[model samples]
Target: LPKTSNREAQKIVLRIKRKCRETESEEVAVSIGIGVATKTEPEQSIDQVLKEADNEMYQNKLSESRSTKSKIVQSLLNTLTAKSNETKEHAVRMTKLAFDFGEKLGLSNSQQHRLSLLATLHDIGKTTIPEEILKKPGKLTDKEWEIIKDHPERGYKIASSSQEFAVVADDIYAHHERWDGSGYPGKLKGENIPYLARIISIIDAYDVMTHDRPYKNAISKEEALAEIEKCAGSQFDPELAEKFIKMMSA
Candidate 1:
C-alpha cells in the first residue's frame, strides 16, 4: 500500500471486477464498486482515512449505477439503430434540433436534457415492429398502419422499463398526439399534451418531412416549412409551430 498511487488502486479494482465477472454464474451476476483513498501523511488518523475511503466508495457506487443504466439504455438504442439506419440518423438530427429549440424556448438545463432523451428514444418501440412494415416502399394497409401507430405506446412501455428512461416515458407516449386531439394512444389535446412531447411532435414532423424514407421522397426544407405552417393550428401547437419555423428559417 505504501507505493500505491490512485491509478494502481483503480487497476486493482478493475482486476477484481474482471475476475468476478469471469467466474460469475447464470444464477449470480457479478458486480462491484470500489474506491481508493491514500493517506498522504502518517499523522492522519486511521478514522480519517477510513472515512475518506468510505466516501469514495459511495461515490464509486453511484458512478457504477449510472454507468450500468447508461449501458442498458445504449443497448436499446443499438438495437433500434441496427434495425433502421434512417431511424438512427433521425434520432441524431432530432436530438440536436430538440436541444437547440429547447434552448431557444428558454427551457431549463434539466428540461433540455429530457427533451434530448425524448427525441432520441421516441421511435425505439419501432424496434419491435416488423422490418418490412418499417421499410415498406408503398402505402400501408389499414392493419399495417395500425401496427405503425402503436409505436408510441410500445415506446412508452420500453422507456418505462428502465429508471434511466422513466423521466421521459410520458413524453415518448404522447409524442404523436396532435394539437386538435386527433392523434391516437390517448388523444391528448392542446396543452394536455406534455410540453416536451409537444416540442418533439413538431420536431418529428419537420424531420420526417425533410428526410427521405422508403415510402416517400424528401421534400424541400421550404416546402416542409410551408406544410408545417399550414398545419400550425390543427396538427401542431400554433405558437410553437410558428416559433419552430422562425428558428429553422433563421
Candidate 2:
C-alpha cells in the first residue's frame, strides 16, 4: 500500500483501540493487526512488516488488559454512586479526607493511592442491597440490618474478582472491622485488620455522621469529630482516629 494509505489505516486501528478502552467492552480481547508496506519498496518483505505490526498489536493488547480492569472498576463505582443514596459528592469528600489522613500519617505514595481508591468505592457493595431495604425511611429490623452488614463481603468479592483490585480486597472486606474485635465479617482486631481499612473506617464513619442521612439529622462538624474521638480504641483504631482528628483540625 502507499505510505499515505498505510498511515491512514494505522489511524483507524488506533481509533478503534481507543474506543475499546472507552467502552471497556469484552471485545477488547479480540486482537486486530494491520501491516502496511510501501508499494514502492520492492525489497522489503511483507512477512517482516506483518511481524512488526503483530508485535506492536500484542503489546497494545497487554496494555489494554491492564487498563480494562481499572476501567471496569471505575465504571462499577460510577454505577454505585448513581444508584445508591450515597451521593457522588460524599464519595469525593471521603476520598479527599482519607487521602489527607494517609498523607498526615506519612503513608507511601502507593499506599495513599490505594487508600484513595478504597475510600471512593468503599460503599459500592451497598448497591447490591434491595432499594426498599436501602432506602427505608424508618429503622431496620434485625434481619434487614443483618443483610445490610453483608455489604463489606460483597464489596470484597467484587473487587477481588479482578487481579488489579485484589490487593485492596482485604481492605474493602474489613473496612467495617473494629479495633476491639467487635466488627463484622472477620472481626479482625488491631493490626490484624488491613491498615488502609482501619483508616477508611474512621473517615467513613466521620463522613456519615457529619452528613445528613434520610434517617438522621447531620451533626455539627465539631460534634462529629467528638463522636469519632469517643469511639477511638473501640470502634476505631485509637492512634489512627487521633491522627485523623488532628488532620481534620489542621
Candidate 3:
C-alpha cells in the first residue's frame, strides 16, 4: 500500500527476469512466478497486512498468466530494478544509508555489508505469502492474518533452504525483533539481538516512516525523526538510533 491508515492495505509484488546468452545476450526468456513481500515492517498492524496481501495475489496471477514468462516476472524484475527508482530513487539509497549508519556506529566493513544486505532484501519473506492474500483491500479475517504473520517463518525457511543465504537467514528471520524485547519470533532484547538485524531494523523503520507507500502517507522527516527518537530504547536501539540519526542529519 502506498499510503494507508491503521486499517489500510495494499499488495506489493516482486518479479525476476532472466538474462542469459542462451536466449539473448541482452535478455533471456525465463519462466517466472509471482513475487512475495519477503519484508514487512513489524510496526504495521496485523489488520493492515491482512487487507493488503489478499489483493497482491490476484494481481500476481494476472501478471504471471501473461505468459509462462509472465509480465509478473517482468514486473518483479522491473520492480527490483525500476521501482526503486520510481519509489525513493532506489533501495540502494536506503542500503547506503544502512551502511553509513553502520559506519557511524563503528561496525566493521563485513558487518556493514551484512547490514546493507539485510536492508536491501529485508522484505523477502513476503514472497512466501500467497498473492491472493497480499492484494486484498478489505479487512482480513483472522485466518488470513495468521497466514500473513507466518511470512517471517516461511521466509526463514526459504532462506535456510537455499544454500547461498544460510549465513544470514537467522538475521533476516528476526529483523523484526525490538530492542526492548517486545518483538516477534523471539522477543530478544538489547545486545541479545543480532547487531546487523538491529541495525537493519532501525534503518528500515526510518525508511518506512519517511517514505510514501501504497498503504500510508509519508511523514515529514522531522516527524519520522521524532518517531525514531521516541522509540529509542523501546522499539529502537538507543545507541544505534543515536548514531543513525546523526548520520541522517549530516
Candidate 4:
C-alpha cells in the first residue's frame, strides 16, 4: 500500500501471495512477491519488506504459465507440457507446421482449422503428469514411456469434458496413432486415424525431432527432416510425410 518511491523515490513492485488450490481439493500456499524500491536505495527497509508481505492478504491470484490475458486457447496446457517458455513456442510452431502441412495435403479449411486447434492442445494431458516426470533430464525408462504414452488418451478425456472443445477430443486421442497401425491407444492406422490427427502427427514428430527436449538436444531442420523422411513408412504416414516435407521445403 505504501511505496518507498513516495518516501525515497524508488522503483515499483507488487508482491502477491494467496492461498490457492493447485489441484481440486488440494490447497497449497501461493505466494506473490511485489516490491517498490528507490534506484538509489541501499537496501530493503523494514516497511518496504513488510509491504511486500501483503501478497497473502488478498488471497486472489492464480498461477498461470502465461500472462493473465491470453488469446491462445492452449497456453495453460502448453505451460504444463514442458519446462520452459521455449517449449511453449515449440508446441505453437508445431501446431503451425501441422496446419500448414494439412493445407499442403489439400485438407479443407475447416479441417485445417480444427487440426491446428487439436495440435495446439495435443499434450494437454501432460498436466496430469508429475513435474519430476515432465522435467526429467534423462532417457525415460520403459515404464515412464508407458505413462507418457497414455497422455493422448488422457488429453482426449480432459478436452472432451470441456464441452466447448468436444470435437477436438477425438483428434487428441488419435494424434499418436501411426499410419501403419504401430501407434497407441487403439491404433487405427491410415485414414482411420482422423485426417487432422494424422496431419498433426507428422508435423509433431518433425518439431519434436528438431527441438531440444528433456532428453535430447535439438538437431538441425535439415537433419530432422531427414529423420522424417527415414521414418516415413514406420513412424509417420508416407503421404503425410511427403506433404509435410514439401510444405517445409516451400
lDDT to native, each model: 0.88, 0.80, 0.64, 0.69
Stretches of candidate 3 exceeding 4 Å from the true structure? 1-90, 132-145
Work out candidate 4's RMSD over C-alphas.
12.0
- Tens digits of per-residue lDDT, candidate 1, 141-183, equal 9999999999999989877767788899999999999999999
Q: In lDDT terms, which candidate is top?
A: 1
Q: Can you tell me which runs of candidate 4 are displaced by over 4 Å? A: 1-84
The best candidate by TM-score is: 1
lDDT of 2 by residue, 1-250 (tens): 3455666777877797677546544322333343434333777787777777677777776775566566666666766666664657788898888877887899998998899888877776776787777768788999999998999999998788667787789899999999999999898999999989999999889888998776788999899899999999999999988988887887
Which residues of candidate 1, in runs, are more than 4 Å off? 1-70
Score candidate 2 by lDDT.
0.80
Worst 10 residues of 4 by lDDT: 9-18
Give the higher-TM-score candidate: 1 or 2: 1
Deviation of model 3 at 93, angstroms: 3.3
Residue 98 Cα positional deviation in candidate 1, in Å, after optimal superposition: 1.0
TM-score of each: 0.74, 0.73, 0.61, 0.67
- Ranking the candidates on lDDT from highest down gives 1, 2, 4, 3
lDDT of 4 by residue, 21-139 (tens): 23212122233333342333557676665555445323333333222222123444645644556556767898777666666677788887788777777887777667777778999
Poorest stretch of ten by lDDT in candidate 1:
23-32
